[model samples]
Target: MSSHAPDQARVIPLRPVPTEPTEPTPKEPLWRDVVGDVLRRERLAQERTLKDVADSARISMPYLSELERGRKEASSEVLAAAAHALGLGLADLLALAHGRLAQPTRPARPLRSRIAPRPTETQSRPGDVRLAA
Candidate 1:
């Protein structure tokens, strides 16, 4: 007689193997691509040429061209000035930049309760205590 348990063979279930080949999904569009599209559209809508926008924005024409073509990424300050030259607000520009960034949204927090320290001792109120040297 065999020594193996009678229930052991019946108890364990078999796992199914995949029959089809798995394929990866295409990558999402880049931030530069989105920003480039926005910049191109805005400039076109205003009937402004690339040279005109670059000149008005006080940025180099080639650099602006690169930015518009998604070959370069722009910093916030640069984007703000560009937006301003396009008659857009800084906040609006920031929103556009965020859309290009496409980061996941985190929940907002309440305003900070702490106050910032003054640069100079004189800036502090007369009633405030002086710290030890």
Candidate 2:
């Protein structure tokens, strides 16, 4: 009964406060892009064209070009064929990709992995079905 006036409610802000800027984080490269780089590098090193490699691999030039441009995700068979066409084994191709992934182009780590990482403690992931070979 002695108060001069009732307290008014303050408005809450919808936006969050800005923080200090930090170094930008690097993103993980896609598997297709990594593989495509290897393929293109090898082909160019050997002085070959897309049509030549595609012909030897028994795939359409457009398809091989797409693969080299990372526009498509090649199957195991197609990858093997392309590798063989380039005088490289499937293992060699994969090794090149692994090396590329291990290289550090930026200071920050990738948010997600582009390839299978080293073994870790078994943890169940959604839609993951382990198969014993």
Candidate 3:
């Protein structure tokens, strides 16, 4: 009975085990992602149809849709045309993109804990100025 119990306790491995632990790679946002987000946000805020913008920009609806979805990398001229169609200059589009990139982000916390003041505020200097002259 003792020998049978010892044999039953031994388990056979069914799959190969990794010798080392693997680290997950962090994902970085692509330029297309940033630009697409800005464009989509602006379009939705203005309550304009994709077809209207595409016609105004002189680009095909499908192409414009692809661009807005970040599936295509548009040329400078195309981007300018699209910006113009949306009543925004190339500079304004780029500025909005830069602003999106400049936004501060933090790891998500529970709602209760998130209500607490941020650590940066406590450690910030009194005269710290963010604006450029």
Q: What is the TM-score of each predicted model, taking all chains together?
A: 0.54, 0.64, 0.59
Per-candidate RMSD, Å:
21.9, 14.3, 18.0
Model 3 TM-score? 0.59
Which digits, one per residue and each the tens of the lDDT, describe model 3 over residues 69-102?
Answer: 8898888888888889899999999999889877
- The runs of at least 3 residues in candidate 3 whose Cα sits more than 4 Å from the true structure, single-residue gaps closed, are 1-26, 107-133
Candidate 1: 10-residue stretch with minimal lDDT: 9-18
Cα lDDT listed for each candidate: 0.68, 0.82, 0.74
Query: Per-residue error at 70 for model 1, in Å?
Result: 0.7
In candidate 1, position 118 carries an lDDT of: 29
Candidate 2 Cα outliers beyond 4 Å, as residue runs: 1-21, 107-133
**Candidate with more favorable, higher TM-score: 1 or 2:** 2
Off by over 4 Å in 1: 1-23, 96-133
Clash tally, candidates in order: 0, 0, 0
Best-to-worst ranking by TM-score: 2, 3, 1
